[model samples]
Target: MVPGFGQNKKAVELYKKAVDALGNRQMPQALDLFHQAVERDTGYTEAYVKLGQVYEFMRQPDQAFQIYQRAIGQQPDNPVTSLAYQSVSAYLLKKGNYQSAIPYIERYQQRFTPNSLQWKKVDRLLQTARFGAQAVQNPLAVRPQPLAATVQAFPSQYFPVLTADEQTLVYTVLKPEGDEDLMVSTQKGETWSPPVSISPQINTVNNEGTPTLSADGRTLVFTACQGRTGYGSCDLYISHKTGDTWSDPKNLGPTINTRSWESQPALSADGRRLYFVSDRNGGVGRRDIWCSELGDDGEWKTPYNLKSINTPFDEASPFIHANGLSLFFASEGHMGMGGYDLFVADSTSSGWSNPQNLGYPINTSDDQAALFVSANGARAYYSQEQSASDGKQRSKLYVFELPEPLRQKVRPVSYLKGMVADARTKKPLNATIELIDLATNKLVTRVQSDPQTGQYTAVLPTGGEYALYVVGPGYLFKSLSFDFTKKHEGEGLTMSVPLEPIKPTEGGAPAKETLNNIFFETGRYDLADKSRTELDRLVKFLEVNPDVKIEVSGHTDNQGGVANNLDLSKKRAQAVVDYLAKAGVAPARIKSAGYGETRPVAPNTSEENRKLNRRIEWKIL
Candidate 1:
């Protein structure tokens, strides 16, 4: 007979009927029958265990715990009845009910011999219970400071995602109409502006929540349910921002979503991997953190269980840091102070390492999730419920500096934000901005500017040189570089770009712009190999417009003698002209000139200004 089987015929019949209902997924009926079976025969252990199983399946741990307590009260020494000891211990420990759990766990461990199931759980539960008691006794000194009205005013905000600069914030809020929506706000100095929904195309009649942004803030991934396009009760969805508007949300498709539930997506900064929560099959738990990488075809690959990071319980609220190596999540499966303690795991070549509990103050007996660490790794943000002076509980969003011990292994980053506009009219222009790794000559990411605001933002992991290039159709491309080897304090760097319209070949006015991509040696006028990409672009532009003629000019800073500078500048300009000619541009279509330290865009008082004064320009003729 099975552990809970009974001798009473009527009770056994009722238990069998309930099991049938459970098998058919009729939850409410099964729950009622199980309760009836136990009430009809107080000794129906099978009925009680089945009732607990149903409660567990429904994620009602407290109800299951109470039922198990009754089972143990009747026959504490029966291995079947003794299940209450372990079940109650697990349920209590999940909420950091340590003192109450310690007695039950100790009793459970006593019933089994060395190395048995009870013996194995003894260590893990005992450790967590002891720690939970100690943590409750002494809390961490760090307290969370609430966010301003800009992000947390009235509507109630949570699930926050931010750019590396910490200036832009996106979060989920329950609208007055009862639907959940994602809202955004930007900071001005210490204060943040009121939040506004990104676009109606994204927020729909159904709910959308738990939004994550890519490093460049161009791609957004979130969760949606119940509005026609979904593979599960809730499935992950994605949207792309172009100019000032967001495209309609598209389901991430079957590979990422199953008949099982999925939600709370956390996208990687590199835009290659995704982390989220699911009750999908083959997990170590009822709910687990899972990840999928972007495939070669631009679709998400099959999700891989975050093996070491998940346990045989629920794991939620995953946040993958922009540096690409660390992950933070909340779990009830692992040993912790209490319900859903925030934990972090470091990524390795094999997979994620075993999670480490964030410990005491950062985690409390109460549940904590939705953790976000700033790019600099100096500050952290999360939401928690606190009782007001009026004795009612309210959820608040808070930020605080990281304590020293918690800051290890996190590398700071830089946020590069800017605007792209027309050179003459100064109107916002939709443009593509590309970030290139100077050392590797690889394109890191490409982002678009807002059509209404001419704005863009990108997060950069510090310790490298990057070239920022902006391009648009029928406009001269712009390029600039940032050196972030040394860390900068405050928020991050910002810049603005203006693209000059390419002049018509037979125009009334000539269109001229300095070629910022051209590079030459310190003294020699020979072009660097890296200058080929830009030269190739020039060749293509001329090829597309066959009748367009252009003039190339070179200028130098005031460091050298005027005569020598002029001589060197002329050679550099001529070298570019020669490259264009060899690359198939007709010689008749182009001319070269040198204006040594003469036409200055900025004063030569600083090194940056001096660098700006030295350039090569192409003017339409």
Candidate 2:
């Protein structure tokens, strides 16, 4: 009997050893020991924690969460118990169970330091949870629902794209033992059929992901790594769906791919252009969104960097709304809660504008990728880790309803379309248009209307008031204000502005003259302060033309007295001269002069003309 007891004790000790090994991520050995330990002591808490941890490592968050809850109940006050609770809360939050996660998050916060990093993470989680809960409460919100039983129970699957009519679905799937592959399902009425593996020609030994289907579902674009012929480590490839068969995958060529990785290709609704991500040259950050337009001859134009919009971090996973005005992409460069967040910017006459963060519940500290907004702008679909109906945690696709107010303002292609025309003839004119954020007065984008067509389109970021200024040589500067703060979803607005010709007396047309190019508000002196940006532009231009001498002339409308107007204009011109001199432009190369109402460019017929009368010009003499 003594010998038998000793053998039982040794078995228990071996079981305990196995459980500890499992906790440390010793998978095979832990598996052997867990089997032995459970046989010896069926109720060991440490053994359960270890077992749950292994399952969690295997991407089974539900099992891990359940075991963690059990361990917490067994030892509610332990620090490890709090950790277990945090794990479950994080998993649930990722699963979009904002309400379900609240209790765990609140409990963790109540027991931990609010200022600690851990607490801060919990705070962000709570904020998103609250937002999600509110989203569910609003009747106007278009809550997104998963298509019934259409998704397969694969180890991992994400990045869903639909055909133009929303009748077909294609996505990426990763099996437990196989490489990631593209899979497609057809929509028969309301239900999507089980996904069928794509053609074997496209699924090589390498990895492929983030598939984008064309409107007709005839073209497919995706990312592939370590391919036979690619410009980078991972490059984008396209395959055509031809009558019940897929053609061999073909590389997008050097025009779209570079020495650096390029992936996540999204085609415009018209299929005339391709938007994708790359870390090639001329990017402001690690990865930038670049586009290649398809020419009429059926060839692709060289890829160009999206300079105005991309930052120094990473920008990826672009989704061009059918409306053509909105371009949604993921970025890490812009200010956000954390990691990669979804951002959208409008396309205007200028290029793309500064992007706006999608905010809160739709975006969290964790990585958010591949967003698709419905045509109505009411609902958005994205890939996220979620809890299954069977209570297992896995990376799955989710859809959420955007707030009504947000949806109204996020148009698929609602844009401010207009031509910078000659005010007198209504003839299109090439000019520079600057979109400035009213809140920060920061220049968001600088666009040049077509010299041939005088037409331009710019991207308008969501929210905020913007000041749009159109400037060009020989034309009176035009200013327009856009109040997107109140813009409704799906509403596209158009504004056609006419620019008046600058009168001869306003400084007279001098070849290569630097037009006052200075921007300011009326009745203000001290340079209007914000005049530095244009001044800097002038400084750079002057630096490039060392032999050029410019006269900075300031003029005013008839509203102000001649003396005051003259003095203000002179001071303003002197301010520009002063700035250039300070910026190393030779002081002798610059001169200042002022002409009040005597140089009015427009007839003093109305307030609008009077506003135009007050101006500035630079003459190269």
Candidate 3:
């Protein structure tokens, strides 16, 4: 008995040593010690957790999940058991097994507080599971059928690039076994002829995989990883086509490339911005999408991280839609259905919002690399290995139509260019404009008119009715609605809006109608239903006038009594003030006030007039 006890104590010490080694990322030593610990005590919970974590880091999720389950079975009430359960649930969710993960996620949520971060994560997981299950049950809820389809696959297969017109096809094809080069094929009549190899200056003995043609087909960017002068194993190179002949390929330079790999370059339609993937330092993850602007000197600006969309995983193969708002890329980090799914995000003034997975069918477990959308935004082109009509199997090109709802939001240009002016004088007025979505009454983006020219341009996402609010220091807040729902094809829009200044009363008192009134609710201290539309208008107004500032004040009717009305009005006013503050409005520009029936717009007599008498107002001052 004494000898057996000594072996057990030694095993416990070895287990502790293994855990410490794992914490320091010493994989080999940790693995050996874990084997010894498990041998001594097969049900050791800590040993299982350490083993699961190590396997997870090694990209063996299946193995990790089994080990985590073993730990869960060993100690059902242990806090670490929940962690193990979550890890396995996350893996299942990633594999589209949301239904199977629901029970585990539900139990985790029931055992923890909803406000805790862990519970919040579980809640999201539950929501996704419920949504996915419903989607499966009602597949019709998901859009059906591609917008269009091609009858035959391309002959010599390679990923194809669509020109701005969406007519010309440029791609790279492997030449024999020794050389790989770019090729171009134009649509002539109903059939496409055999592709012709691009100029000798552009094609080399080295391989080129993906190719991108500029809107005008004047500049071409392609991936040449094994080039002699590459900064890394893979780098993006560009060549310009001047008339018939092509210029020698030039490296994008050190500013865009690092010692780490970078490739798959996509340029905006206007040729002012370049989007590509890089494994450079300071990235949020293994690889991220980055952009470099064309500077005034016509040289590339230093690359800036697209932090809004990137997460701590690989994001690659970016395809900028002809309408610059919609960006399509592949990511392993963002919430996805499977390995490297396709996602699209819009670029707004607030930067890239959370990317949405394209969903099943268009996305699968296999890697979905490059994508090309037609100028009309109706058709999309991708490469896959499905069987074609011919007996011979090939990894050929395929084209499908995008869903109507999604197509409506795909535009060539994202930013709206226009000017705000005084309605009477037609003079430019420095004003604030806000963009609000009519469907959800949410404020989306905001911009300010140039002080010098009173000209303002704001970026607007595709789809929905947007409320435009224009306000100046002493002007009545002007409201207008823009409906981009009819923007069937991607195109740039230009317009000019007029603002009417608020005139002071005969006694020179500030106008009674201030923005504060829009935010105030009823006696309950919560937002009023009538205030919903008005608050949305205010949000849109702020978005349009990004730099404009104002204060919100609340007033009450005399019949409510002085002291009580004073406190009630103050609470109401602060409530409006809080909503705007939470919705990204700067607090310094906003202040709340309570005037207990002192600033009544009308006498408190009938209930109708009394209701109007108690109001809130906003003033630039």
The number of the candidate with the highest TM-score is 1
| Alpha-carbon lDDT of model 3 | 0.70
TM-score of each: 0.73, 0.46, 0.50
Note the Cα lDDT for every prediction shown: 0.81, 0.71, 0.70
Please list the Cα RMSD from the true structure of every candidate, rounded to 1 decimal place.
Answer: 7.3, 13.0, 18.4
How far residue 588's Cα lies from its native spot in candidate 1, in Å, is 6.5
- Residue 446 in candidate 2, Cα distance off native in Å: 29
Candidate 2 off by > 4 Å: 1-142, 376-378, 387-393, 412-621
Candidate 2 lDDT over 66-96, as tens digits, reads 8787766675665656667778777776676
Selected candidate, larger lDDT, 1 vs 3: 1
| Sliding window of 10 residues with minimal summed lDDT for model 1 | 1-10
Error of 1 at 579 (Å): 5.9
Candidate 3 per-residue lDDT over residues 402-443, each given as its tens digit: 765556556633445577776656778877776666667765
